[model samples]
Target: MTIIIMLVAALLPAVLLWLYVWKKDPQKEPTSWLVKATLLGVALCIPVAILEMGIETVLFGVDGGPTNLADTTIMAFFVAAIPEESFKLLALWLILRKNPFFDEHFDGIVYAVCIGLGFAAMENVLYVFNDEEWVTVAIGRALLAVPGHYAFAILMGFYFSIYRFVDKSPKIAVCILLVPVLAHGIYDSLAMSSIVDPSIGGISVLVLIYFCVKMHKVARKKLLALKEVDKCDNESSFT
Candidate 1:
């Protein structure tokens, strides 16, 4: 029963968010491609885990302490954010670089979000099941962490679409990879601060919530703007 609940809690948010993003696309991506991208995301976790472990060993010497601000920031940026987003970007490149269905701008969001949620799903499960307070952890993550991943992916996809379809510049490609890593790093840094100082941590959590909400709105606006561009292109082609 606990396992059942854990699976549901871990997976339900990702599934719901996936459908929501999929529906937002004016031209729906192929189901197979989305599924494949998601699975590749899960597969990429293995390498990410290995990299994270190696990084932690090198940086911390050992685990299991209340992290200081400097340690937390370093862990967040270099240990967590850089490696995770870099690999996700690589997965997106590998899966969709030459795919036939990646014609529209919004396809970037769809594919990137699929990969993000796939990573989130596997990640959520591990965190939830390993903790003693699984329910509390699961609920908190559902609200903040999972949606946070979605926002990061949307940002990545937004820049990636511009890079791929509009400008095709090397700089934009760099933005596609770096922007999300910065965002994810900040988010994790704030969340981890609570361990060292609860008062600061409390303030950071509120700020993080606001940041996530703002990012969500920005991502939605970008998606709508891209859809409008697609509509104009389609209408022009018809005439």
Candidate 2:
């Protein structure tokens, strides 16, 4: 049917992105913990999604409530932004909080990115398979929403790395979660309000891409530094 075709089309982008990220990082083999983290993120999101829908339905009266600004704000802030970020952070924590591979600042970014991508992949499949207009929805999500999620997670990772390397403070992690929640909420509000112009959206995506690339460099640098330090330590011990 036409619906099936659309669904498949929609899944293509997500699949492609997943494959690309996986292939590009073959040095990083996935662990059982990574699978668990992905599952945790997905699981935690369910109740949060229910809460979002419930609040929206109550406020908007079941017709999308014409953007239902108040409800949307509630959904964005409390439901979508907060819960989602918390879950993603949980995913990161569950995997990396005390793991051996988490020896450098960059490891936070790597693990967090994996969690984000896993969540996005599953979520994308659901979207694409759930509707007849899946192709269009998929394109929109892939082009905008999915990348935004990844970027937000990357920010969390970046902060997590900083704190892990220096302070080891829980507050930094809390702030990491809040900052992304706020950004995600604001983005949802603007996106729903039609206030974000196409140019702005395009630029926002570009900016996110730039951030990812910059963070990649930061992660690589830290990793290399750690390797050098380890090498020196090994030599000194032998000498």
Candidate 3:
């Protein structure tokens, strides 16, 4: 029963977020490709975990100590954000690079969100099941962490679409990878800081919430703009 609850709590937000992003696309991607991207995302977590452990070991030594602000920032950006987002981007590229269905601009967001949610689902299960206070952790993650992943993916896809369809520049493609890493790093840094200082942590949470909300709005607007551009391109192609 506890395991069942854990699975449901872990997956519910991911499914809901997936559906929301899917519906935002004016022209949907192939179901098969989306499924593959998601499965790839799940698989990517294994490597990301291994890489992060190795990095953490190098940075903090085998025996971890109390985290200071410097340690938290370093862990957040280099250890967590860099490894995780870099691999996720690699997974995204592998899944969609040669696929014909990746035609529309909005498809980038759709597929990226799918991969992001896949990672979130796997990650949520691990955290929720491992913790003693499973319910509190589950609920908090459902609200913040899952949505946070979605926001990060949205930013990734937004820049990625521009890189793929608009600019096609190496710099823009690099931005596709870096933007999300920066966002994820700041997010984790703030969350990790609370471990050392609860007062500062409280402020971090509020700021995170605000940042997430703003990011979601910006991402949504970008999606809509891309959809419009796609529409124009389709009409022009016909004429």
| lDDT tens digits by residue: candidate 2, 1-239 | 87676656655554565455444442454566555655665565566567667766775567755434565566567656776777788778878866876765545665676677666766777787887777677888877677666666666776777787767688886766876777678666555543324445565556555654554454445545544544665579799
TM-score of 3: 0.95
Q: Indicate the residue-level lDDT of 157 in model 1.
A: 87
* Model 1's TM-score against the true structure: 0.96
Please list all clashing residue pairs in model 3, or write none if there are none. Answer: none
Summarize candidate 3's per-residue lDDT along 1-239 as a digit string, tens digits: 87897899989999999998888778888888889988887888888999988898998898983378888989999998989888888888887799899888888888889899999999998899899999999999998888888988988888888988889888897889888998899888877888877779778889888877787787778778888899999899999
Please estimate how well model 1 matches the true structure, expressed as its whole-model Cα lDDT: 0.88
What ranges in model 2 sit over 4 Å off? 1-31, 54-71, 169-171, 195-239
Report the C-alpha displacement of residue 80, candidate 1, in angstroms: 0.7
Between prediction 2 and prediction 3, the one with superior TM-score is 3
Q: What is the lDDT of residue 57 in candidate 1?
A: 86
Look at candidate 2 and tell me the lDDT of residue 69: 52
Ranking by lDDT: 1, 3, 2
Best by lDDT: 1
| Clash totals for all candidate models | 0, 0, 0
- Pick the TM-score winner: 1
